[model samples]
Target chain A: MARWLLISVIYIELIIVSLGTSSVAQGGQELDWAALDWKALDWEALDGWELEGEAFAQARYFPDNPLYIGQHSQNQSLALELSAYRKFSDSFSLEFIPFYRHDFQDDERSHLDIRKAYALWASPTLEIGAGINKVFWGVTEAVHLVDIINQTDAIEAPDQEEKLGQAMVSLSLPLPSGLFDLYLMPNFRERNFPGEDGRLRGALVVDTNNPLYEHKDKDHHIDWAARLKQSLKDGELALSYFEGTARDPNLIMPLGTPSPVLLPYYSQIKQLGLEGQYIKDEWLWKLEAIYRKGQPNLQFEVEDYYAMTGGFEYNIYSIFESSQDLGIILEGIYDQRRDNALTFNEEDIVLGTRWSLNNMHSTEVLGLWIQDADSSAHNFVLELSTEIGNSIAVTVEALIFSEQQRNSDSGRFTADSIGHQMRQDDYLQIEIGYFF
Target chain B: MRNNLSNPPFHFLASILLMIPLLVQAETAEQKGRAIFEEIDRRDLNFGDFSSDQEMILRNKSGQESRRIMENTVLEGGNKDINDGDKTLIIFREPKRIRGTALITHAHQQRDDDQWLYLPALGRVKRISGASKAGSFVGSEFSYEDLAPQEVDDYTYEYIGDEIFAEQDCFKVKRVPVDKDSGYTQQFVWVDKSEYRIQKVEFYDRKATLIKILTITSYQQYLDQYWRPGYLSMINQQDGKSTDMIATNYVFRQGLTEADFSENSLRRAR
Candidate 1:
């Protein structure tokens, strides 16, 4: 299949080259002018379409013993992301992106997703789009607390940057004061989690096949969202609201069941989120806050809560008189429910520093440490990426857990103590990608 | 001495000597250099808005080559008091991985420019500090400062002399950057005396060493008043690398407004 694709690409390039040369050649005769017109039309047709993609191979190594049986300390995978875009006219365009990954260790890790398949019509004042799409809405770098349009593709990575496309119809209005966007999402997609054989799985395997929803419509329940963003002279403010099923599921372990597995429960939720970013020369202040209601807790009771992630990024450029930039990020995470919050970052601090080498290769390095305020637990992450050439890129990542001390008062394990559960899952990953 | 001064020829010489200081004070080197720059700026004004397609070919010492293609749009802003800088948006279409990526820049005359980068894959826009103007532009040999709009207030100028370059008489001028964060301390520019258009520039690093040379060629006239370069070549003397840039498909007076250059426009750059 790869060879066939290469040959087809070469064939198209040759035709384009020949057409270009012929168009530039003499065209004074009537017949030659007619041929030139046809060639120009063909050229326009070719110019309206574009195809691009990247193929990557990834490997991960864990130094510690696996907590679950059937899990390995080493894993490998291959993935491809291809996108094709076509401009029908100046006002309309279509984009289709298909992604696939194959894992050698776990069956559930191998998956396919359509990242984007959308048709859009845009004018000076309004834009209308339909089909499967991905939308992100947030400002804080530590975590995307306000973004809810797409479901998390958790199996892909731990950072939650990867998302599964959501089927929706969206509208955008650009006004004098700000930009307003409205979305009507019809189909609800479930999040992807690691299988039992995967290293990142919890103590009990999650039975994704049997998910329970609070609404009778289940996966067919319609979701709606809207947002208004305004850019000021030195800052930006955005207000967003979403009404739909919560992306974060509540895991329920059935009692007295023959198969010990956790069932994911999706609850309906209404959330109001606010995002702000203020830029003052070398310093950038960011904030993302969300007020959510009608989400159940571990006790299966509905609860209302608010969460916020606020921080500032200080950029220092040309350190040591070299073409390098250093940025320090300090964000504070807060949850109103405190211990009752479903996330591990109830009250935590994230301190990170990013070093960028403004060179020909575009090398960058990021280091982050997330420290829990109540406990001594901490999560350390490091990432480095660099380009080998115009088409090849390499990335390295490491995740480590340290000082995870379990509560001595309650000897039993609880769902809120995810940091303790992930203590032994430290791993190092490397990825090599070829782009075209 | 008194008798010589009383003579007619000596009196003429004395008057000329007296007038020499006045003439020097009337038009100093700095003032003449600044006037030339102002002329160039004035001729390029009133082009309300424009969009163009640009291509860059980067070559290493070993002769390996790579190509980058992008689309650029500019909205004239400095003419009015409310807007003191030009707004520019650039969208990349080549080097597949960076396709759909966009950059927006608000170039200012007396202060650091405001810039933002939009990554299409991540659906995120990141603000870049203006202090990084010396950074390489998309891994190319050209730096951000090299491409940014040049304002007369950003530098102090001195008229050097006149020289014949490329068979055309040109005026040589030296300019020192006013911003301390600038990578280059001074630069020498050559402008054609006839059209008042820049023809070549020599950049000197902070250590006062010549580092890079840029030459503009293939001049094209637009609207019967403005001259635009169709091709540019930048060579790095210290690195032995070079880049060739070609611009085409120019559209002038497209009726673009300030709204079109907003941050929301970055998302719709494609």
Candidate 2:
């Protein structure tokens, strides 16, 4: 009941903030672009286009045996990303970025994406942009609930940190109170799942060839979003709303299908999110909460729910009088949907620590432990990375899974929980990259 | 005797005679140090705003060297009524991997600064704790505390005897940071007498051991008033590592407003 009240208060605040008049349009001396003199602006003196790129190779080794046939114990992949940027004038610029990856096994794992391709027109008071872009929005170290702008590129990694490019037309207004942004998306992108031969997948693979959607327009449905973000002297806050196709798909098996394959079903959803953070000396407090409607439950019935993740990070600078900084992080997660929720973090605790060596090599280490509140299920992840020379960097990561609900027969494993589904997929990965 | 002491002329004369030594002592080393620093601060008071291109070359003990290039913009802020401090934006341009990365800082006079870092790869702007200001900046010998705008109240000063440095007569001043979080226990600063320009600085660690020495050179006057350094060299005396920072292409009074230094602009700092 208190959660409902808190959401209600936030809704009221959102209404008030949105209703406030925009100061950008209030200026009477707006320039008429059509009447502006173009010849007076020199075109020959502008700087030429610049290019940057990164190429990397990665290997993952699963300690536990594969749960299904065709799944390999070892996986290797290579990826490349290139970005081209150009500035036509002081207020106008263009950027294009393309990425490609190839996997030695699992053909579906190899993919290509246009991370960013956009033209931006910016001024002191306003900004307008349109193209394929990526927008990240959240303030949590664990699960990111408020970040809904892009589809998750799940095939790239299980950490959910990789995102697909989004096609959008955006407008930004910087006012005295805060920065307001509006986004219009005319198309939808589906989340790619791991292939049948992938290691970190459930017993039954998702039939990506055929998918279902609640909206009649399918991938052509129009979506919209808006956000109001402000940075205070010692804190920051953001209020956001998105109405579109849900990023996460619900898997269901139809009765009449010839094969018993799980088909992904995308449903429409409306999400209201709030993010805030405050810094007090060496401690940083963060919170991300959302109230989502029209999401499917386990029984395929649409339901409304609220979820939140709050955390704090305390920093110890120059530990032992050395050039190292250690940050202790603790966070709590709560979701009203409980068992029916798709994510495993319904009620969990996240504890993590980050250490930065602050040396010439820029070495860093991160360790995270997530525990299930009601059961003996947990996940541990550790990562260490450092730079070599001026252009090369290497990273090593390990993911460990522990669960008591693992069935003896992996094939007959039910859709009980994500932690139980992939209990045998613990793996260690290493990556090396060259940037130019 | 009491009557004589109470007499107006006698009392005034006695007080004047007694005040001679006290008056001479009034110009103590501490006050003189503060006055000299105040003069130094007053001379470079207002440039409004400036933007500059910088190159930092890092050299290790093995004599290996690496370079990083960046652009910086600083908005002068000392408005007590508005409670505003100096705002700075630094955007990295070189070392291809970290290109487009930016950092925005809001410095405060009496409290910890507020800092935000923008990672272009993730399209994320993260607020980092300012408690780590004592740490090295981007693996350079310069600490964050050294880059931050130095406010007069941030340190207590004591003027030492004059000395000659770099072929110039300089006043040596010992300054201890008022903030306990400072990496250095104390620092000795040398300022030339002619323009009150910083000539050299020696940093002493917590154990009163000299750790680093910085030298500023290539002074160029802008707007016929402000003296800006064209080059800075900081050497870690104990570690045998050093960093050379060369700043050029300074453009002052660019008419930059507070909006340019907003968090929203960090992603678009290029």
Please provide, for model 1 over A1-436, each residue's C-alpha lDDT reduced to its tens digit, 9 standing for 90 to 100: 2223333544565578666657665554444655557666566545656778899999999999998877889999999999877776877877778899999998888999878777788888899988778888888888889999999999999888989988888999997758899999888889877887788777788889999999999998899999999877677899999999999998889898897989999999999999998887778899999999999865577889899999999887657655577889999999887766777788899999999875556678999999988888888999999877678889999999887756435664433476676678899999999998
Candidate 2 residues lying further than 4 Å off, grouped into runs, are A1-47, A407-416, B1-9, B21-26, B79-83
User: What's the lDDT for residue A276 in model 2?
Assistant: 98
Candidate 2: fraction of native contacts reproduced: 0.55
Docking class for model 1 is acceptable
Report the C-alpha lDDT of model 2 over B32-151, residue by residue, as the tens digit.
888888999899777788989999988889998877789989998885323667899999976656778999998888778888899898888888887667877877888889988888
Q: lDDT of all predictions, in order shown? A: 0.83, 0.84
- What is the lDDT for B19 in model 1? 100
Q: In candidate 1, which residue ranges exceed 4 Å CA deviation?
A: A1-47, A408-416, B1-25, B57-67, B79-82, B206-209, B237-242
In model 1 chain B, the worst 10-residue window by lDDT is B76-85
Which ten-residue region of model 2 chain B has the weakest summed lDDT? B76-85
Which candidate tops TM-score?
A: 2
Every model's DockQ, to 2 decimals? 0.29, 0.48
- Which residue window of length 10 is worst by lDDT in model 1 chain A? A1-10
- lDDT by residue (B1-270, candidate 1, tens digit) is 888779999889889999999887898899889888998888888888888899988777788777778998988877763367888999987665677899989887766777878888777777766666776676567888888877788888999999988888999999998988788999999999999989999999888999889999989888888788899999988878788999998889987877677666677567
